[model samples]
Target: MSSPRFAVAQLDEITPTPCPCGQARRAFKEPWNTLATVHLTDIHADSKAHYHQKMTEIYIVLEGEGHLEADGQIIPLKPMTTVMIRPGCVHRAVGKLKIINVPMPPFDPADEFEV
Candidate 1:
């Protein structure tokens, strides 16, 4: 048997970075893990609509109420609301919200696109 290949991340301890959604703390961004990447996103009123070329994202709302605009369609968001956004879909969060975003194949800045 081989050693366990895994990692643990403390979301709150990670420094938040500026994102279109306000702020985000991304984890597992290393190339070693190509499976997925997790992000703690703080959504603000100024969040902008954007898309990913080759990444799929799963968002789990954690706090606050809001609406997710995807491909021009708005969907209500609340605590425990989960949304799966595929590649090429333009989406953004309206209102103040905190969500957990998981991106498949990890997150690559090069894959993010603004429409």
Candidate 2:
């Protein structure tokens, strides 16, 4: 067996679509324990404010700027910045922000965190 190199996946390759909360997500990730990415476009803070189980999230800003309301505090995230969200945390992304989401436990459609 052999290991493969990890390269930065271009944001242009992901087509944004409406998530369950009406936000757009461009999913990009290898089918392994390396990394998982979800590009979020035009996100609102309310999106992350909700709660999820068995999933820890890290939102990296690819473009634009916005305010993130997590842990009952308001934090501003600009380009080249990252925000970490632990599992079972109520959070959301707000404004015209493009975010690259990395999930440690990966994403399972059936295990999606809902309020």
Tens-place lDDT digits, model 2, residues 1-115? 5556655556665666766434555555556544555655556534644656777778878877777877678889899888888877777666677776777666665656556
Error of 1 at 105 (Å): 1.3
Top TM-score: which candidate number? 1
Deviation from native of the Cα of residue 77 in model 1, angstroms: 0.3
Candidate 1 structure quality by residue, lDDT tens digits, 1-115: 4433988999988999998889999998776787998999998785878999899999999999989999999999999999999999999889899999999989888888877
TM-score of 2: 0.69
Segments of candidate 1 deviating more than 4 angstroms:
1-4
Best by lDDT: 1
Q: For candidate 1, what is the lDDT?
A: 0.90
